[model samples]
Target chain A: MGEFDLIQRFFLEGQGRLAAGDEVPVGIGDDCAVINPTPGMQWLVSSDMLVEGRHFLSTVAPERLGHKALAVNLSDLAACGATPRAFTLALSLPRADEAFLAGFARGLFALAQAHGIALVGGDTTAGPLNICITVMGEVPRGQALLRSGAQLGDDIYVSGTTLGDARLALELFRGTVRLAGDAFESVRRAMELPQPRVALGQALRGLASSAIDVSDGLCGDLGHILARSGVGARLEADALPRSATLAAQDLALQRLCTLSGGDDYELVFTAPAARRVEVAAAAALAATPVTRIGRIEAEPGLRLFDAQGQVLPLALSSFDHFKS
Target chain B: MGEFDLIQRFFLEGQGRLAAGDEVPVGIGDDCAVINPTPGMQWLVSSDMLVEGRHFLSTVAPERLGHKALAVNLSDLAACGATPRAFTLALSLPRADEAFLAGFARGLFALAQAHGIALVGGDTTAGPLNICITVMGEVPRGQALLRSGAQLGDDIYVSGTTLGDARLALELFRGTVRLAGDAFESVRRAMELPQPRVALGQALRGLASSAIDVSDGLCGDLGHILARSGVGARLEADALPRSATLAAQDLALQRLCTLSGGDDYELVFTAPAARRVEVAAAAALAATPVTRIGRIEAEPGLRLFDAQGQVLPLALSSFDHFKS
Candidate 1:
């Protein structure tokens, strides 16, 4: 198949054929997709690229890969307290595999429809498998959440009642850990699918002082917030959230998985201690549970404490594409 | 080096560190770059992906590769008569080659600065070499050009007086053609460095009925305008523009290069026959020479005629990444 046929057959047919509206005066099939920005809104743009073998295993299903590709980008928007608007996907595939394109489009559009976002435009080429998505969103002027907004004495919280299952699944796949049947399948799903906390991020816009999504592990990701906001953090390592399966593991394993387990798309945000009640209310409104695990400090270094308030000297590094 | 350090050392230091202004309030380092669109101006967005061994040869310099990667995307904006604003780049590299990156950034930022556009945000990963750029521009509402706006009696025109040097250079590279030293270098420059007709596109905003960038060959690209506008075209084959280097070649080779020469990032547009003088004025204002080579027809099929007014039976096809 030619590039045009592949796009027409998979992308420009169903879910990709979104109706043009006030926000998007022109969608795909044009020289460029056109957007009419709302009067009082600012556009939020985020781009994420996923490469085969580096970002995902060769064994991943095309449908799941498609979902994860867009999910990661949407996670960026959610971190900024932006409402999803539209996105463009630029993909490089080795060939025009009919089954792969069908499955990928089905999964991609499924998630797009769920968020009410449109696949406005993108490029399709022949090469090694690579997916690059640029998502555009809207946030009210002066209301966007930023990593530089955390204030001293602010309470640091994380959305989702459980996390770290994705890393656990990855470890299992690498044969470094072992799980059986349903347990393995459940954790594998966590590795394959992550829900962007878009609603929670928007709901915490006025309540949360700073925000970031957990992609490069909780500690490393939160370190960004501290560095940008010109503050430090005192993390209660024992209070870190974890799945029931992870919680049942050894204490060290639990800490390692919860603290340095990347791929969790949960939102890590900070709010004033006085607004703790309101933060809980907002979490409830978004139907995403939240737990406080730390606090911003005036000092300029991150410190971790155990249940007994004793400092734990555990070194953790986030996933860096170039380094390792 | 880690991803953050690589970006900081190269992208976020100078040219990439575009100051936040009224248009972009928050750029790189944020979860999502925020854009405050100008009121009454619609945003035009285009994305292009270049993969190694597919879009260009492995022998091409990293700097030239960087230039072409962005120029192709800007050509789309030019086709729409949109003024360049900002762009996001998502790059995947096999390794952290500092030299390659330095050269690429130099070429990329040079073009970006010339266009007065900012490198707002992007993602970097470790994988096969792939560059995906999503460019955002702006044009006055309802004044932006489109392929569907061409009228039946419109005269077709193309910017850049000399064309087909890119294809000639490619053929020479493949050892299918030969040229003298200076001539070869000149055509190679044409293939490596394409100047997008941004000024010409903007100047023709109200005059041109429809426009498209000739990336996939003039014949094929013009077919897009015809199909979209529901019109036909009578192309004067002998009038097709060609560089002196290409014109000196054999007639068959010259015709093939000029008619289906992909990589010519010039604008092919249509305008009312009565607006010939105005079109010439716009071309003069932009300092880009243009040639009238065809006319739109009410029929629904493209026809090519030689200087003798006889139909030419040329089997022309554009470059298709997949089919090729």
Candidate 2:
């Protein structure tokens, strides 16, 4: 069978059992899928690309790749406070390995079903392995959180911990650092299946002054909110949350990973200090833990206070794909 | 500079003026762009992918490549009879080539402006050259022309011409065929920059029963409509229109190129014979010529007739990316 036939048999045909709704009037097998959105609602759209070498190692499992691919795009929606309605995947593969496609689709669909997202349509081709997903979501009018909404007194909050173990797993994989036993496996799972905080995003729709997903790093992504809002932030190094595995490491290593390590896919947001109780309640409602690590300031620069209560110069930079 | 910096300098920074209405509440520089669609319209979404070696050569102009990348996705919208709204580009490049990026963005935006499509959001990464665009458009409720709407007595029509000189250009590039002077340039243009039939699609919304854009050959793409509509087609060779450059070639080469050559981006549609005059008027209104060359039948197979009205064997297959 040709590529088209393989896609039809595996991806398109399988969508028949995905529980259709009124959202998609015309589904797959067409030039375009028609989305019938609720009246007066706003639609949010985003696209994210993951290359084989740049995004993950060549030896990574197809299932993990599939999960990561969709998860990353969902993270974008999470930051914007949009509930995903549907997604389209544009995949390029070196070959059509049925085993790999089956595993990949399983992982992708598992996460998709959890979040109630439907696969509407996409195109598959043969090339250097690459995965690109464009996810569409819906937000009530005037309720979508944006990076430009942060104010001077807004408290900066991060959901589900910072300094993800994904970077630690990368370090160990690259032989730069090593961990033992369950710690290594935990970090690996953190790296491979970073959960997208969709529910927490929906909960923060009206509360969050500004928000961004921590893909690159907490410091870097927060910098985006600061720059866009024309405000700065002061983060307490001692207050930054880290996993037990990350906390066990030395202080310097912990700070390095928390400040510069990326691939966390956590939500870093800001809200008014007075709404602190509401923010806590919202996180509790979504069952995703959150912590206040910093606060917005009028100045246009990022400042970090070390554990010793001494202000330290923010000299660290986020990972740059082009520089590497 | 980093990937984010390059994106800021080229894409996000240039989206300041897009004649924004209430449609786009937020453009680039965000995790997701918020789009507020017209309250009564249905949104159409489609994505297309192009890999370096499979879709184009290293010698292709960067500007043309950009145009083609977006044009192909727009063609999907055109086939659905949707008006272009916004698009997101996921580009993977071997390196950060500023000159190439500028030309590519120029070509892409040039066409986007003509169709009034705004660049909403996207991501760039380091990898082998790959371009995937997800375009969103809108159609009125219940007004979308789908492939399943074709009836047995419908007349099959194709917009513009077919066989597209793109195949001729491909053969010339591979040194399999030789063309001189204007023929080479004409075919090269067809290959490099085939315009998306957006206007033609809008015009055929109510006039045509079913429609599909020819990306794979007419024979294969027509098969998709036949499969979806649960009908078959009989195409007359004498009635099929080929470009002047293609018509001058030998009958065998003409048949092969016209029958199987892909990347035409033309609209192949079917309408009831009673709407023939209205269909012709609609094509004229869009300033795109269309020709009737086939008839839909209740049978479950495609039949082709030669110039002398004898049955022609069906040996042509669409381009399959996997096998190629």
Candidate 3:
């Protein structure tokens, strides 16, 4: 298959599952996709790039790669409390393979269907495997949750655990760690297919003071919210949520992965302390658990505290694409 | 500089001219860009990918690469008769060089400022040179020019000239052809920095029944319009508008480049014979001259004719990433 046939057969031919009720007037086989926007709605757009060697391993499945490509972009929309509506995937492949395309289309459309996002338009090229996805969503004007909205004395909260087992999977792939059967599968799945917290983000609208998706480990991602909002945070180290599997690891490794692991794709937010019950109800409505781990302060720096209330030193860094 | 610093210094930090009256509420630093859409309008979205070796030669200037990358995508929007609004660039580079980034940013923003499109948000990473841009534009509801709107009796028209001189430049670079002095520079600029026929496309929205941008060669791209509109065309070979520089080339090379050369970035559209005056008026409004070179027919295949109306046999092929 050539690039045109590869895209047509895999993505646009019969996406019957994605086309129903879609607002797109012209799609796929056009110079541009025409999308009808809802009246009085603001649009949110974000693009993410995933390189083959840097973002994923060669041993990874094509289906997962497709899912992750779209998921990460959707996570950016989720961070802004936007509802995912449509996305474009610009894929560069070394060569065309029918089976790989089939699996990739399956995984990609599955996730798009789950989020009610239609595949709008994109380009196909031949090169080293690189996937760039741009996702578009809508929010009511002035209602978007931004990173600069964290207020002093607001309760800091996080959705899902502090760190998923994905970082552990990466460590295993790097030959820096080894795990048993079930543990290995769990971590690998987390790394390969991340679930963007779109619903939870929507639920936090008009309630959460500020929100950000934790793509880079908890500490660094939270630091973004702090820096943008010009506020400080005191995180309770002992209160950081962890999976039972991660709890089974050694103390140092557990802290290391939980504190600084990337690819978590979870939301960290802040809400007024008085709205604790409201926050809980919102999380319940989203069907995603939320944990209150700290509070935002007026000062412009972050501090970590153990159970004894002793301040801890900062030693780790976040994942920076160019710097790393 | 790192990726973040590179983007900050090169693109967003001082694009003050682009910020005035822009619809983007939260740009650059946020996870996603927030854009307010005008009421009663539809959005147009398109993405294009340019790889290092496949799309352009490494010897090409970084500034030209930046301009071409965004220009091609904007051309897609132009084909749909949408007003340029904003764009996101996912750029991958082998390393961060300040001078290269400075030149790229200058060329990119110069074109963007000319059209009032702002750079909203994007991601950058370390990898082989690959530039993926997703452009967003707006067209009033029900006014978008589409390829499916062409009628059987519509006259086929093209903006600017048929041959852009890009193919001749490519041939020169490949040692297949040689030009002297200014001719060489002119063709090289045509190849490296083809302008998007944005104003012409917008002017043709209500006048032209169907439209498309010529990127993959005049004949091949018009084939796209015909296929979608379920019609055929009878093209007059002698009527093709060619530049003086192209006419100076050998007849075979001139015909080949004008007929099947890629990267023209010109608009080919169709309108009713009765609307010929309106079409000319539209071109005047756009300040871009257009030539009538063909007519749509009820038949389902394209037929080319010379000055004496004798059918010409097809020989040349268009550029295809995978098959070629």
Per-residue lDDT tens digits for candidate 3, residues A1-324, read 356665665676466224524488777778888898888888999999898777888888989987888898889998999998788888887887778888888788889889989888887788878889999999988888899999999999888863747888888888878889998888898899989999999999999999999887888889989998999998886677888788888866776676678788989999999999999999999998889889999888888777789776666434333122
User: What are the lDDT scores of the predictions, listed in order?
Assistant: 0.86, 0.85, 0.84
CAPRI tier of model 1: high
* Predicted candidate 2 versus true structure: per-residue lDDT over A1-324, tens digit per residue: 577568766875568335345878777778998889888789999999899767888777879888999999999999999999999988888888888898899899889988989888888998988889999999999898899999999999888863657887888887878899899989888888889999999999999999999988889999999999999989987788899999999776787677768899999999999999999999999999998889999999899998777986576544433132
Model 2, runs deviating above 4 Å = A16-20, A317-324, B1-4, B16-21, B316-324
Cα TM-score per model: 0.97, 0.97, 0.96
Error of 1 at B57 (Å): 1.1
Q: Judged by DockQ, which candidate is best?
A: 2
lDDT of 1 by residue, B14-68 (tens): 5445647777888888788888888888989888999876678888888898899
The collision pairs in model 1 are: none
For all candidates listed, what's the TM-score of chain B alone? 0.95, 0.95, 0.94
RMSD of each: 2.2, 2.1, 2.4
DockQ score for model 1:
0.89
